[model samples]
Target: MADLRRVTVRAKTPSEKPTTVDHLKNLIDKVGDIDTVIGEVMSRMKLESRTESQMILSQDTEGSMEWLSTNISKINYGQHPRFSVPQRITVLLPLEALRDTPYLISVIDTKGVEGTTQRPDLMAQIEDPRTVTVLCCSFADAPGGVPLSIVRETIDAGSDAVSADRLCLLVLPRNDEALKIVNDGGDVPSDREEGYAIREGQIDQQFATDGLPGIPVNFFQVGADEPEDIWRWLTSRIEAIRTAKVERIKRHVAAADNLVTNADVAKTRQARHTIADTMAKAAERFRKLRPMVRPAHLNLIAEAKKTHQNSIAASVNRKGSWDNFPVAHILGQGVRIDANLRTRDTFVRIDEAIEGLKDDFAHLSDVAQFLENLKDDVEEARKEFLTRVALAGRNLYSPYLSQAVDMWDKCEARYGAGSGYRVDVSAIFQAQFEGDPNAMTATEKVEAQVGSIWEQIVIDPLLEAAAFEDEE
Candidate 1:
């Protein structure tokens, strides 16, 4: 009755899975100290054991993911708009390689930007034909070291010597003998033929037998992760010294300029004082001249008064004489009226002689006053000239005058061409009589039109003709 029936098992489809409503958040912990990671990776690569090499190579993906997760936290904390984790080296050597040979050198903590002046001293202490391998996070940091391409685009540049075939690589020892060599401050080997031997833990390797040639070397001198530290230190110190020298030169130049400026300022102040003094003297002279010139105006007024009185007196005495006449008959002689007028002419002639004498004196006084006023104006001008010379120091006056004359010439050229004749008649009418002036309502407009036509027909032609005549 218990019949065993074969049950058919079918594969489940993707749609058959149940969706969960619970929100389970996942996040990886962040890594720290990218430099420390780089150092650790480099140290692992330099391992001589095959077992360690395989282990290090296999951890590449996991290490990279961890590094990314850690770097993300740094990005969020730094709050950078654009951030990215830099590409790094993971696997150092091939997995199947029986023996792990870290073909690279690492210099530890060179702190290149400092202690440049003491580089030669430090180099003197090192032994001759020393194998120095520089290790850096990027090959660009090592200028003369062998580059190992352990990751994508990880190598930037390396030294030609290291790139050549046949490199002597050795692991530095931390044993007492190695410490003794370091402390002794003596040479390890004088030549490459007698290369040094590395005895670290159970691994002992000897280098410096020039038997193999043309094999480009990848050296691993394990120490630290610095690239060109000595060179950087020397260069930075040299730059500091050079900068100091430049600053000293600049200070000297600035001091010289200040001296020259002070001298110029002193000269300018002296010149200004001299100009003020000259102006004062000229003003005093002008004041002295002003009083001497007052007699002319007084004499002119007196003469005018006397002439009017004489004319009135003659007009009253001569009843039929033409002594007083209408202004309209000024140009023509009038007919005689009587004999009494003839006798009166003799007295008028005598009076005229006296008047002539008075006029001569009055004219001399007017001339004297004019000369005095002219002298005052000339003195004022002279004072101004002296003031300008003293204040501007005469050296710059010619250029100043030239510029002034040029500006004046431009002004004259613009305004002296009768351009003012373009009269806006409405404005003129409004200014002259306002809207209430009906008597000569169209006068301004007519005059403006006539003037424009006159200028075109007569003024322009005459000017052109004169210019042509001058040319001829």
Candidate 2:
């Protein structure tokens, strides 16, 4: 009627190993039944049953250790029974026991244990096993006092295990020599310390060893005489393991957050750069067109002036009568003869030229206004796009850039296939050449010469440069 919970204690005794059997028997008697002791210990810690408890007894000691077997069976009655007394405890030659026990508390005694020499093998068996192996040994009786080489090798094996946190080696030395040997040249006192009388020190091995270096390993100066102290120390160690696990979780969470943050920052910077570069190119195009405005206006004015002069010359002519007439007769023309005179045709030609000039001037004025407004529009768009970049953090850069590109597309559509100035030229030609034969001839000449030059010098180059930049 014990609260076994998720606890298991196996009493292992290899055949003919009387010392091993005796040691387990004595420890059981002192601690009461293994099941009862574990349940009580868990209760003290206020832990509930998270897994089933198991008690494994080696078949080698089936008939040999009747007293221990009967007591274990009695204690484990009515709870989950993993095996019968006669059933053999698998030596776990494969270390399968380590893997199977999720929260294991293995109590191993090296001196009289069957697999003591294969310490490395036992440690290596743990494949990231989350269990604590309490390797108890009286180093004094460790075949030739457990050579430091074997001790180091065992520690190394445990460290190299997949999960070092899951392995803990608790050295319970019987005497001074054993304690000193296990200390492995450290400065811890050979005598007992305060509290648990457990001198908690770290394995003095290099960090290159697989396990985290400097994790404290408890060494009991007093042997089985202080069972309570030993149990208390073991409990504290378990608590430490739990604490370390929580800390690892926190670290992992922080690492994940940092990775996400870095990604966002990088994307934002790239988006910002793309938008800024596009705006800069657009502004530069506007700057280049500003100087060309004056030349365009002058060309229109010149064409208008030539048309007006030609119209006047063709209409007005002083004939031979004027040459024969004296200066007085010319001045008094009415008495001599009325020679050269303004005709209706002359008046009409002059009026037509004047109207053409006025239309040309109007076109020029409209173009000037369009250019000024275009500059303002571009500046405003640039400002708005940059403001979006500033407002939206790096995470939203892509969306903002998409919006800016959409706006630019609209501008392109409204202005011209590629630009506003190109559209302006087309509009001017339409206005100047409509319904006038002479103007149409002039327009064809301007289109053949000026249009080709504009495409070669301005439009084609701009597009080509933009294409090249996009490739990069």
All models, RMSD in angstroms: 45.9, 42.6
What TM-score, computed on C-alpha atoms, does each candidate reach?
A: 0.13, 0.27
Per-residue lDDT of model 1, residues 1-472, tens digit only: 0112233444478666543331111111133566665555445433333122111333335455355446445443432223322222223323332222223322222323121111212221111122332323321122122212211001111112233211222223222333233112345534222222212211111112212112222212334313344344333433444564576566556545544544344443443343334334433332211111121112212222222333322322332122231111111010001111222233233234334433443323322232233333332332232222222221222232233333233323333345331122112212322233431333233223333433343324322321211111
RMSD of 1: 45.9
- By TM-score, the best candidate is 2
Error of model 2, residue 134, in angstroms:
2.1
Runs of candidate 2 with Cα error greater than 4 angstroms are 1-116, 119-121, 124-127, 139-151, 154-225, 256-263, 267-472
Residue-level lDDT tens digits of model 2 in 15-72: 4432323434454578888897665554553324323334454545435345354645
Clashes of 1: 16
In model 2, residue pairs whose N, Cα or C atoms come closer than 3 Å (at least 3 residues apart or on different chains), thus clashing, are none
lDDT of each: 0.28, 0.35
Identify the candidate with maximal lDDT: 2
